[model samples]
Target chain A: MSGHSYDAEKYWKANLRLIFGSLIVWALVSYGFGIVLRPMLSGIPIGGTDLGFWFAQQGSILTFIALIFHYAWRMNRLDKQFGVDEE
Target chain B: MSQFAINIMFVGGSFLIYILIAVWAKAGSTKDFYVAGGGVHPITNGMAIGADWMSAASFISMAGIIAASGYASSAYLMGWTGGYVLLAMLLAPYLRKFGKFTVPEFIGDRFYSKQARLVAVICLIVASLTYVIGQMAGAGVAFSRFLEVDSTMGLIIAAVVIFIYSVLGGMKGITYTQVAQYCVLILAYTIPAVFISLQLTGNPIPALGLFSTHLDSGMPILDKLNQVITDVGFSEYSADVDSHLNMVLFTLTLMIGTAGLPHVIIRFFTVPKVADARWSAGWALVFIALLYLTAPAVASMARLNLMTTVYPDGTAAEPIRYEDRPQWVKEWEVTGLIKYVDKNEDGRIQMYNDASDEPGTAFQAEAEARGWKGNELDVNRDIIVLANPEIANLPGWVIGLIAAGGLAAALSTAAGLLLAISSAISHDLIKGSINPGITDRGELLAARISMAVAIVVATYLGANPPGFAAQVVALAFGIAAASLFPALMMGIFSKRINNIGAIAGMLSGLVFTLSYIFVYKGWFFIPGTANLADTPANWVLGISPLSIGAIGALVNFAVAFVVANATDEPPVEIQELVESVRYPRGAGQAQDH
Candidate 1:
């Protein structure tokens, strides 16, 4: 364990943060944007209806794709930072 | 080609595709049978999970349910996709990190008790068996309706096709087969949706078509559909809910329930890395969203078509003749999912909400004028998707595609369910604890035998399904949500939970939820034992038994917490295990394939 070369603790904490952070965002958009916040968002016009309608229909879907890719990238970086990178 | 020939071509062609893919990937070892040797790529795993997730309910019943219910149906869209976020965030990565071949194995090891494993096993078996029954039945229903085969024969063919693909390749084989199934089912769902959307809204994209104004009429398509439907005495489209509390709870329950299902959870274990399991969930949601996005459109378009067929003239004019109903109606009636009874002496099919007692509503006036006694069209809501292509007068290929899509949906999940059941039987039950000295080859043989036996049981149930397809799905969901979800969520989140507490929690949830259902439904659904009649008033607080899973989950959490505090904390290593599973770094190993 010389000079923290096996920095498992630090990298592990960072991975947890990323997981929790992405998950909170994930919950906010689907349950938040699609369900609870849908009515308020619908007040702003998209094409013919309000923004909430779009969120329920299309916007939530786009956000989900982004969330997945973002989580994948962050975790991969975390893996490397901890020297657990798979070759 | 004749409609029958067209149906044959569509359904037959899809099966060929499934076989071709299964041939490409042949499972050899026990690892391949269980977790695809833990070597599937994230993207491929994502697509396979999509096929596995979207079952008969998604493919056959969803669009129809959405179409008939209007705004009240938003529950399906929100509830189904929301669970995926829970999977990606709360469950998948950690489960992969803990890294086991089966879910019961995870529970057994995590709690360090065989009792916990047995409890988890019971929950998994109950939920999965109930779920599998519907898939087999859906296959039978599709075959009976279109292929003109006997329903049992349809189920056998479906079971055989699934067995060949599933037994031949195991999880590795299933992963590839499911990707193909997703393509066929999505194409089948969207092609007719595109045509119908084009016809009604002059928009090819069904998702966009949902919100657009009707090209032939000035009002929004939804607005117009609601207008006529209300005029005919039904509730307004997008009408306010009967109980906001029930709707919210039901939706929340479904989300939690999906996250807890063992078959879906095990899909994450097959991925090669912890992070891949997390990402795989998101991709699964993306593929599911395609059909979900189209479902609202399909429902809207089908509703319009049904209305137009009902009222060729304005709503005030005479309806279509009951004797000379359309081909779609004729086909569905043979399956007994849709039936017509001319309650009024009039020959015209006077469709209305014959149940409402509201004064001055058009329904009352119409019913009085026609001397109608009650709601006469005995159509189950699930018939909407299967009947859509014929309702829209699309070519026979679309109808056949719907048949194939239904089978694909049923089989995809069935394959996943079998893997889960067999994995639990051979790996967790037989090898891990029961007989550890068995060789891998011996374990594999046991797994295959369990899977084959499960298929025969599921097929028999499907051919003579114990209940309606939707009813069976609700029972399965209730069991999964109430029993398995709380235990699993607590396992990772709460380090204080001991083996005794976890077992107690599962048992309490399972008994409470099942007993509540059995009291209302039959005793083990044995027909005469349904103590309470199925009705809103009969339910506690007008909460449907289907919605009772949320309460069961809450009971589970409370019971487990109290018991854990009263008992001792788990030993130090288990806490460290939780800490390790929390992160994605240094947590996964690549299998030697």
Candidate 2:
């Protein structure tokens, strides 16, 4: 433990913040834009339909993929910054 | 080769590949059997996870569900895929860092209570078993339709094939075999979709083609579809009839349940590092999105194509004569999935909204004027994906490929789920709790036996499926969403949640979700035993049973917090363990103890 003064608590806090942030986006794209706020988004058309339908069918899933990768990439960087990454 | 022969060749060749992989990857130890010796590359594990996660439902039935339900069915797409986001952020990496073989093992060790582990095992078994029944049923349907055998006989064949690979190689074999299955199923799914897309909109990308203009109608594909369906008295293709709350809850339940499922959870355990666990979740969705993105295109296109086949000239044109229906309809008719009643005996198929409660007076007058008695075509929704290639008149090889793909989807998922059940019984029950001193070899034998038994049970249930079994599959997600997910997430995230609180929360969630479903679905799913009809009108707070898991999960979290506050906190050492799991450091060194 002495070899690494990584501040594990601080690292954990950063990770939680990242998770919380990403999850908000995750919820917004899928449940918010896709379902509840769909009518609000009906004014913005994507192709043949409104933005909400695109979000429901296509946009949310693509966003989810991007979100996971972003989280993974950021968390890995956070691990390195805190000097807690695996050797 | 003949289409039947081609189908046999493709299916038989895929099984041969599976058995060969099984032999190549036979597990030498429990470690190998359980988690592929914990050295699987993230990308390989991602593909395996893709195959493992996309069960018979995703491959065979999802497009049909989407096609039938229109906009409302986006819940399945969003719910199923959105769960990976939760898994990646909330569960997978932490669980991988925890370094356990089974989901229940994580719960047992984390809570430091064998009783909690046992409760988790029961939850895993119920969810996995219920989920596997649907897989076996899907496998049976694929086999019977393609092989021209009775569904029971088809199920037996599927059972034997699954038992051979899963019993022999365990996770190691299933992992590689699943990678192969993923390729087959994806190719099978996408090829037809691409062809259909090109035919309809001249767009090679099915996802894009879904929104492109219908070439003949010169209107956006969806707009044309809406007009055609609406004119025939069917709900508009893009209409949102479900209450927005139920839709949100249903999607949330599915997302959480997908994140919680034991089988999907275990795929992360096979990856070596915590970071790999995170990356693998992303890759798995990338692979899954390939099919999921195409599924909507397939659904919408198939619906449009079927409509054109019936009408030919336009919606107002005369329907296809019963005697002149396409070869695909005749072929599917033999399987009893598509039936034509000809209620008016007018020699033309009358397909429209047959719901007695449809209150559109103008539509009713139009139907009466056309001499349509009621909707004549009793087409099973599950048949759409299977019938897609045939309906589109794609090459025979593509049809053969679909048969293989559907089998791959069903078999891969069934194997993954059976492995989950078998591992829980052997590792969680026998080794972790009942007989701690059980030898590694004895445990492996126990695992194999349990897997064989699972196959028989799944097969038997598929053969004579319970009436509620189909609906219960959705409830299985509800149970997982309510029970296992909250317990596991709380165990990882909340150090104050002790064994009592965890168990109490799980039991409450499980019981609450189960009883709510049983109240409407039937007590224990015994047909004719339901206290009330499973209708939205009878629902509490207008929440469909399928969507109640989200509420059940809320109940779980509340009960957990209240009980944790009222009862003892976890030991300090356990709190430290939770802290260690949250960080990504030293994950590579954490071996399965």
Candidate 3:
């Protein structure tokens, strides 16, 4: 029982860490690049406007797609490593 | 065939497909009704979610708002899509592991309090119902404009069709129908965009075309747009907004609100497994991004097109004569969404920014130099998407297709919202509380009845459509963001949050958000009753009522944490449930009779 509990704790901690990291990237891309630092990054042009405009309008959404798929893949691997994967 | 016939064929054909899907996938039992028998594939579920989540606003109005507002309106795109990321990571998988039929069921069980569940149910119902009214009204507009029907008649037709499929097959029917709807709407959206993009930039992909040099002008589309609009006295198209605080908070409000919306959350419950829930959210975004990516292209291109249309040679040249307005304008003029008046009585349309108080005073010099009066065109923002293909002079078939697509977007979301509303009433309010011992058959009957009732109410409200229908949607998002989202997130993450704490958090969040909105938007959105005027001057630190949900969410979290520390922890069994949900190891198919 103790060993099982330990493994569960480890798995949960790993999950939390992954979520925290992904959320950072999420916040950074949308709020950071898209809104807060848009002016600073205006020097870097994408299509017509600056990189920040692209991120706000197009880039953040594409990154969100990649992030979800990446999280699903990474989490599923973590689940198996912890023997927590649903049979 | 006439354009009207083509429009009818397109719309009627889509209706036929929906009815057929309803017959084929008709719900047989309570499980089928609630969560589509829990057998949906990840990709299929994703497409359904795309259709279900986009709503009329996303399809018909969002691009218009973006076209008009430019970079600031990117919040709609980022906020709406970013919510899926939160859902995949924080909510969907855990909820799937818990294996509930409805969102409130999880809340009810997790907090071990009927009161907590009831609060969630109320929030879910209010949000979903308010949101559905917008869809109904949007569908009515689409019908009136395209099919040449009265808007009220259109609402009833839409209602009858929703009743047929949703009542017959419930979520099962809705899921399949939405897949078809997604295809229709996406094609309708992108085809015109592709044509316009090719026209403007020689780029096939609209997303790429936005950045590419315009073939005609030999300059990037955005640069040209910025130059022209500013030349005519509009702000830079891609200029950074004035207040970072409001933008961040507004975008965050939309993100959390999207994640918390009951209709969207319940779509996850339809997928078979926890992992599928995660993958499904990704797939849904993939399908949605097809339209979303095209939308900005559509917006910028449409804005540029409108500008060039009015100013034939350029802003320096003579504007088009009122009598020589294009066929599209003439047609839209009939709908009254687009009106042309020679404000200067010069017989030529002089469309330029006329608002003296707004930021773009540069237009004043241009206007005075050109001998222009106030802007000649009163163009409603909602006409952008509807008028895009016409603006680009795309073939008539594309126009017909867009009509179908608009209806599909509206109907698919309406069905999804109706299902969420009905399930909350029947599953949580009735089966879970009022009569736990009711038979599965009885519950299914109740679900159908409630769905029918919800549709009737939505259609009636849509037809009458109070002056504040649009504002009510902001209320819906506020309720979900402040109340349901915080409660659900806390319930999953913390076993220490007891019923009392959860209840307190929900009530405080809901009340704070609602009162903030009501205080500015008028108590309950009644016009002129506002304690404080709904303007930037009266706002709390310049945070609009529309963006207050983010602060309301913070209040929920702070209050819940403080209250939970002061009170006892949740029960041992509830803690065990949390532990079980965390692992996702034993999540079988959602429990069914």
- Give the Cα error of residue B472 in candidate 3, in Å: 3.8
Docking class of 3: medium
Residue B382 C-alpha lDDT in model 1:
72
What is the per-residue lDDT of model 1 for residues B1-593, given as tens digits with 9 covering 90 to 100?
88889888888888888888778777787878888878788888888888999998889888778777775677677777777877886788888877767888878888899888887887788788888888888888789878999888998999999888787788888888898899888898888888888888889999988888888777778777877787778876655457755666677677888888888998888887777887788788888888988988888778777877777786878788887788788877877888788776678777777665643365686668767666667777776687777777888778878888888898999999988888888888888678988887888788888888889888887777665344654677777888788887788877899887887787888788778778788778777888899787788887777777878888888888888889998988887776666655554553321
Question: Whole-model Cα lDDT per candidate?
Answer: 0.78, 0.89, 0.91
List the candidate numbers ranked by DockQ, top first.
3, 2, 1
Best by TM-score: 3
Better of 1 and 2 by lDDT: 2
Q: Which 10 residues in a row give candidate 1 chain B its minimum summed lDDT?
A: B584-593
The list of candidate 1 runs beyond 4 A from truth reads: A1-66, A81-87, B321-338, B357-362, B370-380, B467-470, B528-534, B587-593
- What's the C-alpha lDDT at position B50 in model 2? 97
Residue pairs with backbone overlap in model 2:
none
| TM-scores of chain A across candidates | 0.82, 0.91, 0.92
Clashes of each: 3, 0, 1
Model 3 chain B is weakest, by summed lDDT over 10 consecutive residues, at B465-474
* Ranking of candidates on lDDT, top first: 3, 2, 1
State the displacement of the C-alpha of residue B392, model 1, in Å, after optimal TM-score superposition: 2.8
For model 1, which pairs clash?
A41-A52, A42-A52, B522-B530
